[model samples]
Target: MTARVPDAPPHRRQGFGAFVRARAANGALVVQPRMGFSDPGHMRAGLTATRAARAHTVGTVTLDSYTRVGDLDAVEPALRAGTPLNGYPIVTHPGATTRAVLDGVAGPDFPVQVRHGSSLPQHIFRRLIDLGLDATEGGPVSYCLPYGRTPLASSIAAWQECTELFSHARDLGAEPHLETFGGCMLGQLCPPSQLVAISVLEALFFRAHGCRSISVSYAQQTHPGQDTAAVFALRRLCAALLPDVDWHVVVYAYMGAYPVTEAGAYRVLREAAELAVRTGSERLIVKTVAESRRIPTVEENVAALEYAARAATDNTTTARDPGTDSQTYAEAQALVEAVLNLHSDLSRALVMAFERGYLDIPYCVHPDNRGLTRSRLDEEGRLCWAETGALPLGRLVHTGRRREVTAAGLLADLSYLRRKMDREAIGAPPGTELTGSA
Candidate 1:
């Protein structure tokens, strides 16, 4: 049976969605950092520093791996032993502890979103509910496949329940905002069409489960032109399908590999900011120079945020409109329609779509994934489907020259940006072809 979405009240202006919309309306791009600390004092300090950065910004409480996988026992032991965790242990931390972390830092001007890679996020959601944090990002397939081995069916069921639980945050006077992580599956090499389709489909799932405020995400891919077209396609799809919801697009900086050189890192981030501004994306998730080496310091995060904000301002008046008739848009539309037509229930439809290989992510090895699809970076550096598998785009997209992506080819593609940017740092011309380089 198709579960009807209950009527949601008018959106509150103080919520995360409204805050972002209001900022964007005033000609500001909201930049955020994926930062979290196990210590409440340190987390609070990070949030405070983020708020103090010279940029229009938001804060994030990204959770640690243990809490994300629901291994609370491991988290307790680590915390008790003072072993530093990679991110915040939201589930293991006390409610008062987190409250202290956000007591005065998180407010209208500085809304915070909890970012955790979890398919079963019930424990995490319960804590967020208690803390009245209404903003978070994850999706059934996006969180399930890339992060762990959780069965797709189990993840879908868990996400549905958690999304429904999030929807009720309105009763606590906080409007719930959920961002789909679908566009960033496997972080790189997946064709933009599939990314756009999955993002839109996940947003639809969020809406059908009663979330009224949503944001669709897209990561910066190999080619700027392709990323531009993909973001435009994502926005067009959302505008058509999610007419009644409060929605926006968020651009994540190059997610696969980071450049070793600080200059290269900044160049990539500046490109991402330019992409966000040019494509009319309302938010950008900033990555710092330390990404390729270690967890970025709070100072590095602030520097990246400030720099991206500056780049956005510089390009604010020169936004481009890619229009809706491109190949990316058409392919994404076909994929979304194919999935929706599979079943009346969005969750069931998604499951069946994967089961039948109608929606496949290239290079993803999740057991639920059909593994027939493959993608490669073309000579122009745009991601293309090397093999279409059973994605409904067989006739729609022509794989001009099919080449098997060998192990060496895959490694090269994975490090494409790192090499290109590092070369540029050493006075190589911009946009140099990176065909064969060590």
Candidate 2:
């Protein structure tokens, strides 16, 4: 049975998607941080601080690990023992408590999103929608492949149900927004073309399941040039496919290994902001300098947000149109078309795509993943397919010069950005490899 959002005043505030759209219209990039605390007071304080930041910002209630896995029973024990969970335990906490957390903090100008890495999010969706909150992010494929062992078929079904339930928020005059994590599969190592393809495909899946407003995400990767082209392809494809849907592009700071140096961290973050600005992405998810060490304090998150905002402001290069003829665009479009041809039902098509290896994530160990595909960093630091497996790209991807990724090569590639940024931090000359452990 489908749960419904409780009654509310008509048009009480701006919707999440509407907020982002308005901010983007005014040429201000909306920046957000991935922050959550177990205690309601701490969570509220975090949101309040994020709201008070100098940049145009949004709020995030990232759920605790236990809640994300649907382990509600475990969350109760943690709460009772006063053990601080990694994130907010939305399900375990009473609705009134959550309301208290959001009250005054989330409003027309500052909207909040519930971000949980869950394959089964129906309960989370029901809780958020009931509280009059309308934005959250995840997708059947994106949440499943990277995070857990949940069968792909089950995840697809659960998301289909949740998407339909989330769509009901529009009836309350708020356009519920859903963002795809597909572009950030396994955090790193996957090629950009596949990332773009999965991002678009997941958006299509959401749209087909009843979500009207969406955001497609692309994570910062090995090469800025390739990342730029990937976001361009994502936008162009979304334009062509989702003409009637309200959509935008969001860029995540490099999701792989982080630089241990504060300067290195800031350098990566600044580049992410510049990438967002140069590509005309509407939003950015910022990471902090302490990312290499520990969960950042609220102050660190605020600093990162402000730093990213300043970076965006200083980048004078406006977004230029990346025409649809680029290699990334062609490959992504082909992958989308190939998958869509598999079955009329997007969910079934997704299952069949994986079953037949039409879609595969590199280095993802999920049982649903084919594990046949492999990717390597090229001499220019661009991600290339070392082994194409069964992807239907058929010469669309040139793997000729790419060598198989060795164990040592993979380790170095993972730390490629970390070493490069740490090198630049101390004004070390380019190509001078940083010595000693990461």
RMSD of 2: 4.3
Window of ten residues with lowest summed lDDT in model 2: 1-10
TM-score of each: 0.95, 0.95
The models' CA-based lDDT, in order, is 0.88, 0.89
CA lDDT of 220 in candidate 1?
95
Error of 2 at 281 (Å): 0.5
Model 2, runs deviating above 4 Å: 1-12, 429-438
lDDT tens readout by residue for model 2, 1-438: 001123334665678877887888888889999999999999999999999999999999999999999999899988999999999999889999999999988987899999999999988988887788889998999999889899999999999999998886676557888999999998899999999999999999999988888999999998988998898888889888887788888999999998878888899999999999988899999999888878989999999999999999999496566777788998899899999999999999999999999999989999989999998888899988899999999978778765767999999889998888888887778777654323
lDDT of 1 by residue, 183-235 (tens): 99889988999899999999999999999889999999989888988998898
Q: Cα miss at 370, model 1 (Å)?
A: 0.5
**Model 1 worst lDDT run, 10 consecutive residues:** 1-10
Clashing pairs in 2: none
RMSD for all candidates, in order, please.
Answer: 3.9, 4.3
